[model samples]
Every structure is written in C-alpha cells, then in structure tokens.
Target: MYQTDNLKQKIKLFMIIFFPILITQVSLNLMTFFDTVMSGRAGAEDLAGVAIGSSLWVPVFTGINGILLAITPIIAQLLGAQEDKSIKQKVQQAMYLSVGLAIAILLLGLILLNPILNTMDLEYEVRHIAKFYLITLGVGIIPLFIFNTLRCFMDALGQTRMSMIIILIALPINLLFNYIFIFGKFGVPAFGGIGAGIATALTYWVISLLAIAILYKVAPFRDYQLFSSWVRPRVKEWLEQLKIGVPIGFAIFFETSIFAAVTLLMSAYSTNTIAAHQAAMNFSSLLYMIPLSVGMALTITVGFEVGAKRMQDAKVYGYIGISGGIFIALFNGIVLFAFNDYVAGLYNTDPDVIALTVQFIGFAIVYQLADAFGAPIQGALRGYKDVNMTLVIALVSYWVIGLPTGWILANYTSLEPFGYWVGIITGLSCGALALLARLIHIQKKYRNQIENSSAT
Candidate 1:
C-alpha cells in the first residue's frame, strides 16, 4: 500500500505486514504445539493418537483452506486495481463455498474415519484415540472455515493486525480449554488426547465468533458492508474462484500430505518412534511458521503490485521477501542445531523419545534454507495467479520424487526413520529450484508484455 518506491519504505511496509502475520501464524501453530505437549504429558499413547489425528486433519483442512486462501490474493489484486465494488460479492461467494465444503468434509470424514484408522497398524489405544479425536475435532470445521475466510479477507486489506489480535485473544482461551479438558477438571472426564481435540473445536468457534464481531464493529472493515446484503451463491463465481483456488489448494495438500504420509508410515514403528517423530515434527512446524508467514505476506504485497500493473515492483518485493526469509531460516537453523536436545526435552521426559526427537530435529535444521526458499516463492506465484504449475511441481517434487525416495530409504536402507527426513530435504531443495525458475519465467513474461503495451 505504500506507493513510494524507496527501498527503506518498501522494507518498512514489508515488515509492517510481515510481523503481524508472523505472530498470527506462530499463535496458530502454538495451539497445536500446546495440544501435542499437553497430550504427551498425559501419555505416549495419547500423544501418538493426537499426532495421527492431526496427520489426517492437517492435509484435509489445509487443502480446503488453501482454496479459501485464494481470497487473499484475489482481494489484494482487486484493491490494487481499484475494483472495490466487486469485493463484497466475491467474499460472499467464498463464504458460501466454505460452508458447503466444510459440511462435505465433515460428513465424508465421519464415514471414512473408521476405515482409515482400521488400516493403520496402531495400538488399540492409539487407534481409539485417533478416531474419537478426529470426530470431536470435526465439530469445529465449519467455524474454522468461516474464521479462515474472514482472516483472509482482513489480511488482503493490510489489516493483518486484526487477526493477530483475535488469535492472541484466542490463544490463552485455547490453552485454558486444553488444560480443563485434558486434565478432566471441573467434573469432566479425562479424555486425554481427545480433550485436546475438544479444546481445539471450542477454540475454533471462539475465534470465528470473535472475527465476526471484529468485522462488524471494527472501522474500515465495517465500511465494506460485507454482511449488509444477500448475494445468492452463483455457480459461475464459485467456478471462477475455484479455477484459481483448486490448484493452490492441491499444491498445499500435496506438500503437507507428505508430512502426513511420513507420520502414517511411522505408525508401524514403536510407539516411542511415533511419539518422537511427532514431537520433532511439531517443533519443526513451529519453526516453519517464520518462512510461511513471509510467504503469506508476499502474496499480499506482490499481488497488489502486480494488480497495479507494476511487475518490476512485484519483483522487488519477491526478492526482499525471499531474501529475508532465507536469512531468518539460517538464524533459526543455527539456533535449532545448537539447542535441539534442549528443545526435544520439552516434549517428554522419556530419554529414548528425547534422543530420537533430537536426531529428527537435526534433519529439520538441514532443510530450513530450502523450505524458506520455496515457501515465499510460492506466495509470490500466487500473487501472479501462477498456481497451476505449482500444483504440478509440488506433486512431482514431493510425491513422485520425495516420497518414493523416502520410502525406499526408510524401508530398504539402514537410515530407517531418518531416511524420510533425508528425502524431505531433497524434495524441498528440488521444489525450491523449480519454483525459482518458474517465478523468473513469469516475471520476464509480464515485463515484456508491459514493455510492448507501453511502446504501442
């Protein structure tokens, strides 16, 4: 939104947008971190159950949320292009699409939950907890979807701080709920890991209601009159958004589901192995929030510049964002490398679990730079609406190349669980290279188009 081309101003704007998003994302992931830590204290079985449930929930939820994420770039571009009149309707249509998707996912998840768990070679307790956890977690799907829709809307308008504040408010409430539920306080039966799911479901509803209240009562957002008029859901608009959204959705799904797949593969190992993997992954995910936030901010900044027909400015933003992300990742990797053992001990007291977790975090450290590199570039591509190729790249990189290599290495070699991490590192590095190339191509094409138009 800062119109000045000054480098200092650009960096300031990027930071202004990036920091709130960083907090928001960190807060969101912390909820999961709390769930893992609290459930782990309850029992190893509890921790593994929650981890498996999360593996199922994450891919499905993020994939669908990725579709709704299209709203950010769409609205950002609309704002940049000064197409304000169309914003309200697009938002309404997205809301409708979200509700419909939530209901379908909930119902389908219910039908498939038992079948999926049955297939996993899990302990009886682990399987039981995983099944019920997902079932309880399903209660929040609609609200979560709605909350994300509102969050994306707010974010596109450079109002990242609003969502940050709302989630900050939700964080303690979520922690409290987790404590009360997981510990069985106040006459509630101790449901262990399932309590975490209940707490999360309740927290989702809390955040959704808070977001709606903020939007209605807050200035500027209220001026949009988003809720003022009824816009009937039209198939045409749904398809239009989906055209942009589906690729983004599946691209995220493919990438995230690899982690989920690894979690699933770990199920056949000892309960300790599963627990260790989950803890390391949970910590790794917390670290990942940094680069991920950078990418989300890039989508907004780059989308706005591209929409304003300033391809060069968009390129500058991409460079700033990507470089900043990698630098932070290097710092994170160093810290994580130095303190991984201490970090691992935060999850559980069992020495074996801690040791395994520390080893896994080492692999996480190795991948940080590559992960930082790819994530924000994907955000930049979304800004250009160049998402379809990203989907293909993600599929090929993670599934075709990464997962297969991991499977062979884990099953056929001595590396065992650590082999999967090697594969993940390899995949992330490859994806980063491919994404960088694609971003370069898109930038050049647009620059040429602009030059020709100016010459004529």
Candidate 2:
C-alpha cells in the first residue's frame, strides 16, 4: 500500500542533515566543557557547585524539549501528506502548549533550586554557588519556548542546518561571556562559579534570539508565518498534542532522574573524583550529539513517510538512521577509547582526576555505542508517534533497572564509581534492545496487514 525508496539515499540524506547538527551540538558541548573547566580551575567547590546545579537545570530544560518533540513529528507527517491547511493551526497550538509548559518548568526550577541545594548538605560555599547558578539559569530560560517553536517549525520543513548556524553564533558568545564573567579576565570581576552561571544564562537568551533571526532570514519558512496568527490554541488540538506529549515528557523525566541521581551520588566521592566524572560526562555529552542528531533526522524522514502512509519507507528510514548511528558510534568510540587519557585531561589537569576521568571515559565510550543504537530507535518511535510503548521501556529501564542497579553496585559493592556507570550501560542496553524489538514487530505486523489487504 506504500511506496518506498532505496536505503542509500535515505542514509545520504540523514548524514547530510546530521553533519551540521552534529557540529552544532559538539560546538555547544565544548562551550559547556569550557565553562565547567574554568570553574574547576577556580576551585573544586566552584566546579562542584556548578556541576550540582547544572544537573538539576538540564533535566528541566530537556523536559521542555521532549514536550516540544511531540509536535514535530506530527508536523512532519502533515507536511508529507500535503495537509497545508492545518499546518499553521497545528503549529500554533503546539507553540501555545509549549510556551505554557516551558514557563511552568522554568518557574518550577526557580522555586525548587533553593530547596534542592538546601538538601544537598554541602559546604556553605558549594550551596551558595549552586543556588546562585540555578537562579540565573532560570531567569534566562523563560524565552526557551520561542527558540523551540521556531526550531520545530524549521525541522518540520526539513531545515535543521539552521539550528547549527544559530548555535554557531551562540557558542563563541558563551565562551566569551564565561571567560570575562567567570575569571573576570579583561578587567572584569571574578565571579568564579557565579560567573559561570551568569555566562550560561546569557548564552541561552542569545541562542534563542539568534536562532529566530537565523530562521527568519535564511530558511524557507515563507509558507508558515510565525507571526501571522496569534490566535488562542484550539481546545481540541491542544488536547490531542497533550495526549501525545505528556507520556513522552514522563519518559524523559524517568531517564533524566537516573543520570541526575548518579551525578549526585558521585558527589559522595572525593572532589577530584567528582571532577573526573564530570569531565567524562561532559565529553560523553558531546559524543551523544551524533546519535541524537541522527535520530532526529531519521524521525523527520520516517515521520514524513508515515504520514504518507508509506510504512515500508518509514522502516527503511529507521534502518538508515540506525546504520548511520552505528558507523558514527564505532568511529567515535574507537577514538575516545584510544585517547581516554588525553580526552579526560582536556577537562582538568590533576593527575588523579585525569586517571579517574580516563576510567570513566573508557566506560562512556562503550556505553555511548549502546546509547547510539538506542537514541535513534527512540527517535524512530517518535516518528511513528509510538510514544506510549517507548515510555514503558524507558520507565522500566531507567527507574526499574538503572537507578537501583547503580545504587547497589556503587554503594554496596567494590566497584564504586565504575559500578555507577554500569547502570548507564544497563539502561542503554535495555532501551536499545526493547525499542529495536518493538520497531521490528510493529513493522512486520503493519506490512503483513498491507499484504493481506492487497491479496483480498
């Protein structure tokens, strides 16, 4: 019932789109690493403070990203089906919902940061630094919805390279702000950890604004006018998006919680160990961008196919995405594993910290490959609008297996920090295996049904 194209072109398209995204993400991640490294040099407490606060902030920000993702695939499908009439209306509705959700998350972050730091039971300096970091981070996050709304529309129209360009502008600005604000270089006051917070807050606003300008200037969004109609969201459409988005949000939270919990636990180790762990994690974050960007590309392609009711085409796109991820992951893994010592040293200079970071980096490389396989599968599921089942797998993987496994191994066994990383491995393996099986099963069933109908 559905027409399909060759996998080679699909792979090519995925890569072509992914390259820019990968570069943007890697650049942005390096900016973050630079910020953390700057603070780490000021003092371990300064570094620890930013690390603790960032863990809390990122999940909240990511939750909004997850919610916005719900609208993107639907927009993709709508594009493929040539449903131009409803496109503006659907995007407007999703934007309205996203703004509300982003505000809510930002507010929650603002209100909870103090309560959270109060409970961290750290030294007063650490707690003070974390609290300041969170408050400023929250201040600038309010405009995040604006960025996502434009980006989502661009994504639906197959214009993701613009995201790279926008971030390219923001990356240098962030580094500049961090340099001036953190160490007070160039005659600025040394804000230290507080300066990192200030720089981060400013970076978000710059990226959000810069991204919009880039979208309007360069992209082919002449069809979808972002300012044309500021109508109230249709109640019916809002309900539909929420029904699709909320479960995915929960799944994002489930995964974020495991990583956050582990990062917090690592604080129980020596300050240097925590620093080492953060460096490795920061680098891993960069590696993660490859799979994430690939997954996103596949989602767009697959969603386009699915909306056209070309199920086979969708499956092929998924295959292309996963293959792309495997190749990228293997290449990056080999490089990271080979240069674990150098890679860890890039974040901090202490010998013990570097050694610990090397250990974590080795584990992260292996886990990233597993994560690479899983990330695209999640994106594919999103493409098919298959959030509910994926949510179950995420819940079981992170909450059921990941959290408890890490705690038991890290606290009770001799593995300690390495034990905690095994949890990341378990979660990735479960997510990848479970989602892969589900994707195949669904494709097989749908294909059979189509065949049966044709026979009739």
Query: Pairs clashing in candidate 1?
Result: none
Candidate 1 TM-score versus the reference: 0.99
Clash number for each model: 0, 0
Q: What are the per-residue Cα lDDT tens digits for candidate 2 across 1-456?
A: 123367666666766666876787677677668778888888878888888887777666666677777787888888889886878778778777877776787667667767777776577887788888777666676566767766777776777778777878888898899889888888889988889888977887887877656645653665466557667777798878777777777777777767777888886777787778878887888888888888777778888888887888888888888887889889889989888988876766778888889888878987888888888888888888888898899899987887788888988899998898998888878888998999898788767877898899
What TM-score goes with each of the models? 0.99, 0.94
C-alpha lDDT of candidate 1 relative to the true structure? 0.93
Error of 2 at 433 (Å): 0.7
Alpha carbon deviation, residue 157, candidate 2 (Å): 1.1
Q: How high is the CA lDDT of each candidate model?
A: 0.93, 0.79
